[model samples]
Target: MNKKLSPAALTIATVVIGTLGLASVPAAATRPGRAAAVHVAAHFDLASGQTPENGVLEPDGSLDVTFSVARQVARVDPDGGTHILATMPLPADGGANTPILHFAPTMGIVRADDGTLYFLYATGTADLTGVWRLRPRQTPERIAALPADGLPNGMALDRRTGKLYIADSVLGTVWTVPVTGGTPTAWTSAPELAYSAIAGANGLKIHNNALWVSDTDDGTILRIPLLPGNRPGQLQVRATGLTSVDDFTFTGRGDEILAALNHPNTIVRIRPDGHRTTVLNAADGLQNPTSIEVRGTTVYVLNAAYVTAEDPNVLVAGLRDLR
Candidate 1:
């Protein structure tokens, strides 16, 4: 689940933005590696709880998104059509027992090649808090139960290894579960992943035989190598000073990253050497940007508007010279 920014986080965001020296500039203005054009691809109903938290791009150009507060998973078509796939049931106690955020939230979501969709749901109860599986034409079911006190924030599926990696923000631990669904094991619990004030490990992705995670409270990106026998090697810090980063994606280049700085309301490209460049900002229709997806020369950004509480939408931008 996403969190409201505290005073300390706001202070850090100011420092980070000032350090980048990129403010609300014109969308067409040229920067080192900024997007050439940005436009709203879809607008969601914030009042109705259609805020997009995380998303996955479908092969046919559809976007599968999890509506966090709505506790629903829906697909947004290229033509701006929304089709509800599954809606998680409301908790019996009306989510009073929900961990951290105090409401049942459907967070990260990923689609398998076989057309099955897997997502994370945290309701602060043993029975309802866990990873969920939604097969085509079938109702959603809980496949793995996570700790009730922990909030599973981000998730990634390793196609090569058939394993799913989950980031428990409250617990500050990374868990590994088989795609077929069973017991979830604690893959790694590091100090770097623990929360200092806000959320801990917020976003996760597997790239180049390594697992990449974002620490929301720490404002850093971490990398863990996938060793032989599906074991984790060492944890390494990839980038820092990225305040309020939620989810990120690689630019198809070696190790360059485009991350969503949620509270900062900007998208930055972090290089392998830790140098950062602001690519998109509030001028590009960003409202608490949560996650991003890149395909070919286009970038899809999700703006949840959780804090802004206005104009929740998805922005599409052109990667002018990112190649």
Candidate 2:
């Protein structure tokens, strides 16, 4: 479940934002935030704890997340404590467990207007499959599924058209699927996972009339316009200095984009005008953040520590304490 700020906490946050606003009366300030400490509300797949994957911050501040433990998916609070939702048991001998266990725990998640949650999880273990939906506040039911080929790793939903943009890691393609549950059509293909290839197609979000994706293998932020006609056209590289850019998000006014890179384990802020600045290091902001979701002034990141046997995801928050 998502954590709700108490009335007192909300009041305090508002005051903090007000104070920060005073120092920003300047013309155009483009600096990443200071090294702020993030509170870890949930720890998934911790050695001794539960396993979780993609997560979303409910509009009301509750958590709607996924836990890929076996063929079943689990939903819990930010603290990984309360059980808010869960999926029906997976079919017996559904498929190979090795691949599914190796590649995906769960790749991405996007919420719909009616509070429905959509996600991309492993088909057996290694397959990067299609989109699946669960009605909000109810036990998860299979609404739809995408292709199991090419390893579909990242996903984003356009609220305007109800279309989903999916990035495939192996085949180097990004496709779009209709929310009404139909066949997904290809959008674009690339050459180099870095300069053009679509390696590690990890995270994605739709904002500012484009679909933003994190290509970790190539360490770049890719964006394609979302004009009319539902076709993804004109791909552009937004940011390029990071070693391994994973998940990213847009700030308020859709002015700034935030990204977390691997290797050095850092977070960077990319200005709308194409400027780059450091936000935080591994010590301060995150470990290995995989995806991000935003709701107004708050930014929620899933710092998925993927090395150890247990896959733990840390939630780093940035609350716009605007005065």
Candidate 3:
């Protein structure tokens, strides 16, 4: 979901989603001293509504991705081949009631060690809006129901606790539910997570015994400690001035992270001290980059092209800093 603009403005912007445009790599993207050689690992068919919104990378180098507009989940291999895993049915109302996007879209995904996939689906209807699970070879099923009035954008699974945390972009709420699927609980609702004009609480990750959330509207990242008995501690602002950050992942090097700035078409490395560095940008074939996944020194970025309406692709690059 490339959502830097308000719901009203984004709806108007979709009028141009069908128009394609050529992109020129910025001079900074290819300037001297930039060490990463970013390349497209997979290219999606935008015409088929294949906008890769978010994904999780598997150990075998395969990417499990959600096709936002098509309401489908797919596995993209290293060789650029795609295999459809599951497809959510179209809502009867054509998704007109969907909170922000106004279209039933699938977002956020996490893969379990057992090859089970858990993802979010929001259709503005109680019947289909919630957390869904796909087992190895079974049909996708809704295990937990979320508020249809909210938009679940990003999620993280805490394997140690058997819990899943979901971020609601519209209601500005963080929800927690069991991995086995049941009713969801409103884990927290702080002011920093409230949406201003656009959205808040856009991305989420469980790292270092804490839950880190990104507020797209406020351009800030917050950390909430996971206390004993799963209680949430005081909120702490970790980083600021990060507008348009949709989803992020920790670099596994302390508190450092790589975040996707959707509107800017850039990905940045944010240090624990609030320092930021532009890691990749338009020159690196980014078209509204949405989410990031890091495995060792390799970084995978998913481009939704929701704003650019151009090439929706998955870009892979080596992070020299991580090396």
lDDT of 1 by residue, 1-323 (tens): 23444332233345434544645323222344344467788988775677798999999999999988778999999987888899999889767677657678899999899989999999988889999999988999999999999999999999998899999999999999998899999999999999766689999999988999999888999999999988898999999988878999998888999999987789999989999999788766788899999998889999877655557788888876433
Work out candidate 3's RMSD over C-alphas.
4.5
* Candidate that would win on TM-score: 3
Cα lDDT tens digits, model 3, 254-307, are 999899987778899998898999878887788788899988888899987776
Candidate 1 contains a number of clashing pairs equal to: 0
Candidate 1 vs candidate 3, lDDT winner: 1
Per-model CA lDDT versus the true structure = 0.84, 0.57, 0.83
Q: If scored against the real structure, what TM-score would every candidate get?
A: 0.89, 0.74, 0.90
- Which window of 10 residues has the lowest lDDT sum in candidate 2? 22-31
Better of 1 and 2 by lDDT: 1
Cα-based RMSD of the predictions, in order? 5.5, 11.3, 4.5
lDDT for model 3, please: 0.83
The residue ranges of model 2 lying beyond 4 angstroms of the native Cα positions read 1-37, 48-52, 68-84, 87-104, 124-128, 192-198, 308-313, 319-323
